[model samples]
Target: MKPPPFSYHRAGSGEHAVALLSALGPRAKVLAGGQSLLPMLNLRLADPPHLVDIGRAEDLRILRRAGDRLVIGAATTQSEVEYSSLTAAVPLLAEAVGYVAHPPIRHRGTVVGSMAHAAAVAELPCVALVLDARFTVLGADGVRTVAAGDFFLGPFRTAVGPGELVAEVALPIAAPGTGQAWSEFSLRRGNFPVAGAGVSLTLHHGRVAAVAIGLSGVADRPVRVPSAERILLGAVPDDELITRAAAAATEDLEPRPAADPAAHILPVPVAPVPGFDYRARVARSQVRRALTTALARAGGTR
Candidate 1:
């Protein structure tokens, strides 16, 4: 079905985009990449009265570094980042991009748009959580920076208040001796994982100096497991320790179905969990696998 009627405004710059959104009110939506918004519009899941197209906003089409963090603009496509030098600073973000749908989608899908979309199985949000990515949001009031933990409110929700749009995101560069790994179980190569795990491990003096674990498809929103992270920090992870950490990560993760998917009318996509126990098992094993790989790459193990 075609999307309902709407007024379109092509923004020439970031400030223009924000001003357009501010004037349009809450029912208005910012359009970038159109990878997520278009489909939702066509299905009538979202019927915004106005669309502020920022895809042509040159300022938001940037990819650069800020000191120790890699910054990505709102219009920067995932494919752009995947093949850019910025990935050298945060390889985990690049690896996660490879798992977001397929080549064509990534070519047109904006990274910040995916974060704003806030899909349950999206990999970017999970990676952002682990990498300490900061979202810069622009509104009529002004720009504000938000941490990943505070940015993601829940499934299909975010801290981006109405009249605000994400302008860019900054992800910290991994420290030396750090190993990053992403492990997920998807039915097909590009399909969203039923359960996914991301891990970054920094080894110093043969022990874990710093670590972060991010999980997707196991809960309502992409989440980081500090309980598991706490167990491995400053420790030499062995099989037993890894197993315990994995178990702790999934222990209280109540696997629930995605909800309020008004955009998907195709009999509702299959829920990620067949049984809660089975889903937890998959998520736990992913964490375990990610930890092992990260440890090996960090030179903590053979």
Candidate 2:
């Protein structure tokens, strides 16, 4: 089905985009890559009255380093970042972006769009959460930075309010001696994963100094398993300890129900991987694998 009628306005700049959204209020949606919003519109799941296209906003296409952080403009495409040398500052992001759809989609999908889309199983959000990325939102009043941990509220919902748009995202550069890894279990090459996990580990004197574990596809939104991190802090990397941390990461999770059983989708197959128990098991396995990889990269042995 075609999307309902809507007025399209091409924004000349980031400020212009904000102005358009402010004038149109909640009825307007910002179009960056149109990868996420277009699909929703085609499905009749979203029908905005006005679309403020920011595709030409050069200010929102920035990709550079600021101080100790990697600043990515809201309109920057995933593929652009995926292939750029700037990703070296945040290797976890580089690895995670590879899981986002296919090359064609990544060529047009904006990184901020994926975060704002806030899909429960999206790879970017999980990486952002693990890295503690910051989002800058532009509005008529002014701009404000929201931490990734606090930005996502629920499925497809975020802190972006009416008349506001995400202007940029900032990911902190990993300190020396830090290692990161991303692992997921997707049915197909470009499909969303059933369970995914990312880990960032900082080693100090051969022990886990700092650690962050982010999980997806097992909850309503991307989640950080601090409880599991606590288990590994200051501890030597060992198989027994890894097993305990993985168990802690998944012990309290309640897997989301599968999509409607009768959708009869192809390529987009329904989840027949049993129920909560099976998903939790997958989550555990992913957590262990991610931790192992991250630890090895951090120069630790398991």
TM-score of each: 0.94, 0.94
Per-model lDDT: 0.84, 0.86
Distance from true location, Cα of 34 in model 2, Å: 1.1
lDDT of 1 at 194: 71
TM-score of 2: 0.94
Alpha-carbon runs more than 4 Å astray in model 1: 255-273
Q: Which digits, one per residue and each the tens of the lDDT, describe model 1 over residues 1-302? A: 78889999999999999898988898899898888788778877788999999889999998998899999999899999999976877978877888988999999999999888887667888899988889999999998999998988876789998889899999999889998989998778987777789999999998899999998877777888989999999888888999999999986666454442311212244343344465567889999999998888788873
Cα-lDDT of candidate 1: 0.84
